[model samples]
Structure formats: structure tokens, C-alpha cells
Target: MRGLIAAAVGALIAGNIAAAAADNSFAVRDVRVFDGDKTIPLATVVVEDGRIAVVRRDAPIPAGLMVIDGHGKTLLPGLIDSHVHVFPGAEADALRFGVTTELDMFDISRDFKTWKAQRTSLGRTGQADTWAAGLGVTVKGGAPLEMLPPGMSVPTLDSAADAQKFVDARVAEGSDYIKLFIETLSEYHDRRTMPTLSRAEVCAVVAAAHADHRLAIVHTQAEWAAREAIECGADAIAHMIPDRVVGTHFIALAKRHHIFFETTDDVWAGASGMDFAQKLARDPRVAPYLSPMQRATLLATEKKVTPRFFPTVLANTRALHAAGVPLLAGTDSPNPATAHGVALHEELQILVRAGFTPQEALHAATALPDAIFHLGRRGRVAKGYRADLLLVDGDPTTNIAATLSINRIWMNGYPVDRTLPKK
Candidate 1:
């Protein structure tokens, strides 16, 4: 099934190669614009030479340019997924659902250059842009060891010197950022045990990354681990603390340090229910955009409800968000019932359910991630930004689920072909 989807995506890419190479320009007039930060009730946005040219009220339509009448539609900056695991066709699946950028937390292969190039390559069609942390730093026989590919090397760090060396190697490999693993298996499983990096080691890695001018993000599912990561000067927390509700002290500390958080609520929710996946696959608005592999994976199995930690996760996220700590929307994609691209929409809904206003949810998925990651020239509908945008039938700023009603998606001024071939 994966092969079939890959082949179909390849054929679509080949068919669009000529269109992708040509210079693209257009204007979306009379649209309700969500300019990353707020909603502009009525506006016109123009794109030319693959960049936003003008964004204003009642702009004059230029002669000889293609125009899309966006009456009653809302225009938003393309969604950005802050946490994902990239694989073949992942970007294609993401683009189909209006996710134009995906920030990968870890990839066992450590092939950063290839993925980075694919992201920045202009005039490419049918793929979402990507930024990656090549390989995550973990301890010997750590949490991720069980998940690593059969023969992949599992490097361990103990001393501060070892931490520095590990970070240096990742920097040399062109990692966009550094990812540190600090998970304790006991937090998630009853009997399993795993080693974690010491606080000194984590601090050392953070210092090394900062010396190289890179942000270090940490993965932790427990409160103690999260507190340790923050004390160690990690810039972001990749997953929310799931074991219990975080207190005001930790929230204050995170705010003081300006640490961003990715509340991967979809991951935790999916862990207990194949229902989440099935619901997404069955949604009329999202089903049309999913690829064969995605559809098959979502419908493949039904698992009994297990103990869920997401209620506490949501509470912690609300606390951090209310305290002015930055939040990022991310779905730990391709994990269990979570699918790439589509999972992000579910995440936005989850955020709204967790006490975020719909606009706040949109901000978490758009402007916030771009600002936090320093991803330039994207994630906003403004003059001089990259022309990555999504047009939906209703106002998503008020009703978050409207995000899935994608009317059109533009990447670098080119309209993406959203049609899927019949089986």
C-alpha cells in the first residue's frame, strides 16, 4: 500500500514538473485573511515570482495576472507541524492537507542534507518543506533503543565531554537544531526500564548547541524530566508532560526562559484509541485528501482502550498557555493512529478543546512555530513572505474544524493539485 501511494505521488510530481518550473503568480481577492497573528475581515493578497507582493484592503487588481475570487473564504498561512518523523511520501501527504512545513524531531538515518535540500528547493511541486534535527542525543540503552532500526548505532553520553562531542558531530552534519532525549520508561510503561541522560550531560549538550548558534529541544514525558530539561537551558519541550498537571512554578520557569512547547496531544490520545484515526479517515473534509497508505493505516487495526494520560497533558498545556509560554501545534505523526499532515488538523481541534480560543489554536500551528524556530519568509500572509497559503470555505479562526475544509492550497505561488486518482 505504501508502494502504491509512493508511485502515485511520483507520477503526480512528474506530471506537474513543467508547471512547477514555470514562474507562478496570482491574487486572492476579497478574502478574510488570518495573517498569522489576527484576522483581517476583508483583504486582498497578491503573489508574484513565488513571494507575497501585496497585502492590503481593496487592492487594485493588476492586469494579466490570474485571480481567485475568494468570496466567503478565509485565507490562512499554511499550517506548520512542529513535531513529526519524516519518511518517504510524508511531505506529499502533508502538502495534500495544507501543511506546508514540517519540523522533524528525529530521524535515525541522520541524512540531514538530503531532506534539507528537498525543503529549500524552489520550483518543486507536491511536497511540504522540512527542517530536521538529524539525530537525537540519547543515553546508552535508553528509551529510543527499542525503537531504533535493527542495525543502527545507539550512541550514549555520560560525561560532559561526550555530550559536547556528540553535539559537534550533529552540527557538522548540518542539523537544523539539536534534539535531546530525557525519557524514563517507567513514566509510560509498568515494568520496562530505560536509562536517561544525566542532567550534567543534558546541560553540556545545550551549551554546545548554543555555542554553535543552534536551539536545543528536549523530549520528556514526565514532570521531573521536563523540569530538568528547562534547568539545563533547553529551548523547547517537544512533548507535553503527560503524567500529571504541571504546577505554576514550572510554568513560571518556562515563561522566564522563553521555552516553547509542542503539545503533542494527538499522540497521547491516539495511544489509547484507534478511534481517532478512524474518525479522521472518515471525516468528509479530510478523507478526500488522504493517500492510500494513510487511509489503510488508519483503518488497519482496532485496539482496546488503554490508560490515557492526555487529560493531564491537556491540563498542563492549558496552564503553560495561560501563563504566556509559547505553544506549538504538533502531532507525533506516523506514530500508531496518527498520520502525517492530517494529524495536525486534529491537533488544532485538540488545542481548542484544551481551553485555547480558535484563533489561539491557529496561532499555535502557524505564527508561533515560525517565530520560535526562526523559519524565515514563511508562516504569514504579509508582503515579502513566501507564498505558502491555505484557503478554506469558512472562517477557521472561529471554528477550528473549518481548517479541514481546504478549498485551495498554494506553495510558493503554485496551486497544489489536490485531486486523488480513483482506486
Candidate 2:
């Protein structure tokens, strides 16, 4: 969902740092641990060889090892941003704000190879690990093509058979999931009409992805399109529909099918001419970490209330949550008014406003997204999980904004330098 290359450059630009600790191990003593689902009060967490070695209330602190004081702080699993567009340095920016992993919804950059290599190593890279939908499946000249930069092309399908081929090719390309652009929303703030894949084509791609053992995520913004996606058995929906109030029937259908959603509220707020993005950018807690691109992108969004569907977006999110549906916190970042890490924190607050307790909202950003997308061994602070953790000033379990009070962050058990980047 990111914009122009120049704008991306501004966000990705960062101040650099040196290598990891000599042994890549440490311990956080006497901390309140949010182990993704529940809380562990006054625990000692040991990290060794880039994974959690021990988690106990009174774990032995080995002599001669580095120990970070966790007094008055809450430690949580480093965040997993459910949706983003990864440009270079995007991962670093995410890590700067405690997001250790990213679920990239769409890209043609083919950086997943490098991402995998970096993640496999135990060295400190100061970047978030990533899983991407390398090239989304769409009709020829479909949804994103209109949104993409000029001359940038992704493979397209003509029929259901073509959709099948695209699925296989996407799998071969190392896409972590399948993305189907099924957009046909009759109205939008942008007011740009584009072609979308048909129901048969959407079904073909979803079926093939399942056969290949890939999760299929559909991009739809209308109630009808979402209904079709659920019936076609999409693993998830990319964005909440904004055109109208979501119905009980649809909520039941989603639950029956076990469909999770990525809440890209920032994207729709910009679309509906709301100041949600601007207000978040101006947040005193969040503003200091903004890169030049984040500042530019956030402030440059159009300020018109085209179509005015912002209320419906919030209503649907509340309705869905009230029905006990799992919602993942995602900012379609580097999009119009959304930046990478900063936008995700804003989403946590928005979820809280939508009736999610701070703890439940934290789960949406941490455990839920990781499990829903099958990102293994990195979403919790339990023993043997990857040692990607965040230490913040206040207990985020009680106040979601406490996530932004980041005191320290670790990726693969190596301390991350949280200093603002020197663009």
C-alpha cells in the first residue's frame, strides 16, 4: 500500500549501528511479561542463542552475563505487523518501534530472499523479519495496477485457468501467501474505478493456494465482495468493508468460516477524509520517531470527506469484535497517510476505542496475527520461542498506548539501538 519510490526512501532512511553482542544472549530480570495471551508478573526471562531459554519467576541469573533491569516496565513479545508494504529500511523503521516481524501484503521487490537470510542468522540486523505475498493475483489491469506506479507490472489472469497458473507461479516465487484483488466497491473517496477479478477467478486462486498450502488473503472493500470472499473460503479479508454497516449474517458467515481481518483503519480514514492519520502523526508519544517520509506521507493526505464512509468502518470493526471475531492490527502502511511502525501503534489505540481491552488489542497485534498467518516461533515470550521482545515503561496490558513508551527492544536476543534515525 506504499506510495512513490521517493516517498518510500524518506521513510526507510535510517541511522545505522554496529554488530550484535559477542554471544547474542542476555536476561531481563524482575519484569511483568505479557506472554502473548496472559501476563507473568515479576518474572526473569533468559535469552540464549537467539531464543527464549528460561522464563521463571525466580530463574537463576548467570554470573558475567548482561542483565537489563526491568523494574517498573512491562515486557511483551515484539509486535507482528499483519499488513505492510516493505520498502528497504522499512523493516528497520518497524524494529525501531518494536515490530519485529511484518506480514507484507503485496510487493514485487523480491526482497524476501534477503529477508530470509538475515532472519536465519543470529546476528543483530536492526530489521524486522518479513513474509510477503510477492505478487498478488488480479485480472489484467486490475485493482492495484491502477494504484501502482507507471510501468510497474504484476502477472495478471484472464480466466480461472489463468488464476491457477498465477497461483503456481506465485508459490514458486516464494510468496508466503496468496492475495486476490476482488475489489468492486461502487463508491470510494478516491472515486477511481478499476476492474476486478470475477468470482470464478477468485475461487480458482483460493483453491489452488490451499492445495499448495498457502493462506489466501482477499482485498475487498465492499460488503458484497466480502461475502463472496468468505463463501469462496478465503483465509482472511485484507480490509474491513466501509461502504455500509456490516450485517449479522456476514459476521456469522465469517465466524463459521474462521475468517480473520486486518484492520487498516488508517487507510479508510484517509479515504473518508478523516483526520485520524493526521491526529496520529501529531501524537506527542508517536511524533518523535517519525522519519521524513512518515511525516510527509501522513500530512499530505487529501483532506476531503469524499463518500464519507468513515463511521461505517469503525462500526463494522466494533460489530465484528463484539461478535468475537479475531481482528489483526494492520496499517496498510506507506500508503496515503499510513507509515510503517507508527501506524500500527495507532491501530492498537483505535482497537481499544472499538471495545477491545488493551490486553485484547495487544493480542491482535502480537499473538493473533502470528498464529493466523502461521509465522512460527516468534510471537510470544514463552520458552524456546524466538527472543524478539519489547520492554516498555508502562504495562501495555492495561493501557495500549503504553506500547509506545518503548524503553528497550530486542530482535533475536540482540539489543536494538532505539535512537531516532539520522535521515
Candidate 3:
């Protein structure tokens, strides 16, 4: 009789273990779902095996699945910051601000691949998915030459033949898009100003990139270079030129070619010369980084441009929005002025003020950017989309600022720890 009881107990334990394994699904219940257009209440989203298996209204909980009681929280597709430069601790900051995906515009291929791998590992360990464009290929001494320290400048080819060689080398090195930097005609013409690639050189780079099935994003102000970039089939304009109003021609062309625009107007609108002058004069975060000469320049900018010059910057961005071109959210983060993470949220708020509806701004941050980059399996909350999503305490459809109050983030169906304190 004892032998019979032992065998029966082993059979019962095996059945219970199998039942627990089957119950490993997750159900997020009673949440407000922002289904990319409208918000619906009392929605339940189910995830199993890292995919959203079901979305139903007032659905009963499936046995064995873990349930996340939403407590009337708002749910939306995870935010995407189309352009940023990542540094340490960016993952934490992104989750805190509801940014589920971040794209770096100028990272080395090897380092970028490593970052991508680590980001995937972070997702497995519950962090946001991180992506980057491997490097910005520019004329060695062009616009970036203006900012880079001596000896660190990337190469600038003199002739179209040299440009082809440069392009070939970069492709072999695994670059994503060829990034050309054009600031002024003088920079190209006058070697003293900043040695820039000739027009033929630029065209050669673009052609090479296209031949290799890559795109080109040119960093240029409105000028001959900008016009030339458009004519040469550049995939995107990195920023909106503020010096002159862009005419209907570029807009019509952009629409026709499906070219994208990343209006990084936030960097210009939120110029920190005045604020940083004050902060560098006294604050702890920046004072350490400033040399005495750098501090002097910051102080001088406040006296020169703070009150009168900023209005023009705001006016230009407003005009760009009226053009109805495809605008992507880019913060120019990790730069000296714009802070990373929360800065993209601020950029979205600025975008809304610049004439986009809350939904439109959210769309720019999510769907529009994803579509532009051809990033598959991200930027949505549908059944087949990657499980990159966020939860908020308030309805974003009502108040877009609720996006700033990110409560939880899920990347690849794994819960990431909130950088902000839990409510």
C-alpha cells in the first residue's frame, strides 16, 4: 500500500509542474489602450512567448497567466527618439521618460554593434531596445571639422575618384548611411574656412551609398549644398535650415521622393547660452567642464543673443511645421546643450506647440520614425509587433504630458525597472 501511494504522489507532482509551465503567459487587464488612433477603456492585452497574443475588451483572465492589474492606467506604444547620442546610464533615463527605442546617428560600426548586442541583452534583462546608425560619413574637414578637435577630424576627399574610394572604405567598414556635412559655401570653397568636399565628391558619396543599398542623410543649412543634396537623391535632411524659408519646391519633392526630415528645432529653440551662462557661473553640473575661455564665450552669448535672437529660431520652426513635411523627433541629445533622455520628451512638447496635434507629435515619435528607418517589429502595440510598450498613470490621449510620467516599460515582453520612483 505504501509503494502504491508513492507512485501516485509522483504522478500528481509531474502534472502540477506541467500545469505551471503552461501558465507562463501574461495578461495586462483593465488598462486604457491607445490603439494608435483612439483610446479604449477596460482593455486587456495578453502576451505569450514574447508576442501580443490577444487584445480584448473586458476579457476573462486565462488560467495560469500572470495578471498585471492596470488600475486604470493609460497604455500606449513605446516612444522612439529618432536621434540621440547615447552615453552611460541612458537606458535608465530612457525608460524613465517612456523612450523604448533610441537611435544613435554617429556611432562607430564596431561600437554600435556592441551596443546593439548589449541592448538586446538588456532587453533580456528588461531594458529598452537600443539601435544606432553606425557612423556619420562626412567630408573630413567639413562641418564636423568645425567642431572636432585637431587631429581627430575624419578624412575629406579632394576629387570624385577619392570620394568613391572613401565611400568604398566606409562600406567595407560597415557604415549604415553616408552622412555629409555642409554648413556654408565658404567652407567648401575656401580651404581655410573648413575644407569641405566638392560637389562631385558629395554626389559620388551619395551614389556609392545608394549602390550599396544604403541611404544618405546630409547635415546642411539652406544653401547651394542643401539644394544639391535634394537633387542628388539624399534620403533625408538632418535639420531644417533656418536662414531662409524653404519653398514649396523642396516640400513637393520631399513628398514625391518620400524623403524624411528630422527637424531638430529643439536644439535651436532651447539654446542654453543664457541658461548655461548663469549655470556655469554658479551651478555644479557644468562648471567642471568649462574652461575659463569657454566660460567667457558662454557669458558673451547671453549679452548678444538671448532676448532678441531667439524669436527668429522659434519663427523658423513654426514655418517648417506649416509645410506639412514628414517631421521626425530628434533632440540632438548628449550635445553640450541638450540633455539626453527627458530632452526628447521636451522636444515632443515643443513640436505640439509648433502646430502638431498631440496625436501627430506622438505619431512622429513612434510610427513615422520607425517607418522611415525601416525598423521592423517595433513602434506598435499590435499582435505581431515587438513588445515595446509603456504604461502611464493618466490618459495620453487627453493630456500628452502624461507621456512624461512613464510608469513602466516593456521591451521584448520583459518588464524594465522604472527609473522614476513608483507611485
Q: By TM-score, how accurate is candidate 2?
A: 0.91
Segments in model 3 whose C-alpha atoms lie over 4 Å from true places? 1-25, 37-42, 116-123, 146-153, 185-193, 272-322, 419-423
- Per-residue lDDT of candidate 2, residues 1-423 (tens digit): 366776767645531112224456888899999999988878999998889999999899888667888889999999988989888778887888899999999887977688778766767777899989988888777887777788877778889987667788888888889988887546564566678988998888899999999999999988889899999999999997788898889899999999989999878878777777788777776788777877877776755555456678889999999998889999988888788787888788878887889888889988888787777788899998899999999888888889988898888888887676775
Worst 10 residues of 2 by lDDT: 13-22
Candidate 1 pairs with clashing backbones: none
Query: Tens digit of lDDT per residue, candidate 1, span 284-392?
Result: 9888778887776556543544545767877887888888888899988877777888989989998998899999999898888888888877889999888889999
* Pairs with backbone N, CA or C atoms under 3 Å apart (clashes), candidate 2: none
User: What's the C-alpha lDDT at position 185 in model 1?
Assistant: 62
* Candidate with more favorable, higher TM-score: 1 or 3: 1
Report the Cα lDDT for residue 288, model 1. 73
**TM-score, predicted candidate 1 vs. hidden true structure:** 0.91
What RMSD does each model have against the real structure? 6.4, 8.3, 8.2
Tell me the tens digit of each residue's lDDT in model 3 across 233-293: 7887776554555567755666676667776665555342325234423544334433333
Instruction: Compare the candidates by lDDT and give the number of the best one.
Output: 1
Rate residue 79 of model 2 by lDDT.
93
